[model samples]
Target: MQINQQIVLVTGGARGLGAAITTTLVHAGAKVVVNYFKSHALAEQLQQQFPDQIFIYQTDVTDKIEVEQMFNAAKQHFGQAITSIINNALVDFKFNGEDRPKLTNLQWSEIQTQLDGAVHACLNTLQAGLPDMQAQHFGRIVNIGTNLVQNPVVPYHDYTAAKAALLAFTRTTAHELGEYGITVNMLSGGLLQTTDASHATPQVVFDLIASSTPLKKVVSPAEFADTVLFFLSPWSRVVTGQNLIVDGGLVKG
Candidate 1:
């Protein structure tokens, strides 16, 4: 799928990384549908920014029915099939290492919730969009992940474990979906300098990360979002089942 012509669906596209991806893709000439569970104001704000190219659908992406409904509505609104998706929706989480529960105190329910948000949500969106992608012979699926899965600098155990599982899904789906010209991949980023989720992070932490990285700065949501366009572009037609970490070379794959 060429990005400029891609009919894209972005989960949790109302704010943070999702919002950046949605807007960047829109500016590149792709019509974007944002699947938002909340933040109606944020969703509406995007509408004003790209009134003709942005569409908002309220959906819990873990629900198969709701995901399918969003897909159908997007096609109806855009007058074409959605050719790509960026699974960036997240359950409530923060990067506070100090307050995070230790392994001994962590509950199974905590782990389960992260799984639902990271793994199952990807499953729902993929199932809903795969048929259309197969019919069209092109698809680009990018799951937003975290650097913690690889480096674990902060030990967000539940979050990292869930993303690791999501990577497994990315690879397996890429293997199976290859025959249909569909590519599945992941983009893992470190503590983004600024996001609604990362707003709680202290400046000292950001400075420490910046000084540690080769680029001398923490990754920004917009910077990571730009990489998404690459996966959707025809340039990556031959690539799939890969994990690309975009943390200013803090961790190499």
Candidate 2:
């Protein structure tokens, strides 16, 4: 389906990278359901910018019941099943690596929290959305990931491990759902220039990354957001179960 014809549901679509993706979709004429856990004001503000194209819903994605309610509301608002989903939510996370718990100090609960955000939340949405996608024989699923899985320079143990598990989920789901005409993919990016999550990152870290990448600058949330368009577009119908790194040549693989 063309972008303009799509009905997309973006989790955590109130601010930062999620907001960027929501804005891009609205501009492309797609009807979007912007789901947020908190950020009600920001979500409302985003809806104000394009009231007709954006519908805002408040729900914690990690909760199965909340996710179901969000999807039901989205379908009712759009009068159609969501044709695309961008799992852009970063539940309970910050990018201040310097303050991250040392390996010996990290708790299992911390890793579990990341897993709940990355894997469990995604599972809830996928299952909730699968029926409609199977009925229509069309769907696009994009899971946001990090380059740290490949190059764990900062070693965000819990975050990286959770995303790695998500990548595994992405490919396996794509393989299983391919016969039904659904495509699942991942977009992995390096430290984004600045997002609510990344804002705590030291400026020196950003500069160090920029100096190492071929682009000679940090990638912006908008840049990462734009890449999401391809996965949703019909042009990517045959592309599935793949991770596309969007870190401006920071990780070639």
Give each model's whole-structure lDDT: 0.91, 0.93
TM-score of each: 0.98, 0.99
Per-residue lDDT for 160-206 in model 1, tens only? 99999999999999999999999999999999979988988889999
The candidate maximizing lDDT is: 2
The alpha-carbon lDDT assigned to residue 100 of candidate 2 equals: 89
Q: Assess the local accuracy of residue 217 in candidate 1 as a C-alpha lDDT between 0 and 100.
A: 90
For every candidate in turn, the CA RMSD to the true structure comes to 0.8, 0.7
TM-score of 1: 0.98
Q: Determine which window of 10 residues in candidate 1 has minimal summed lDDT.
A: 1-10
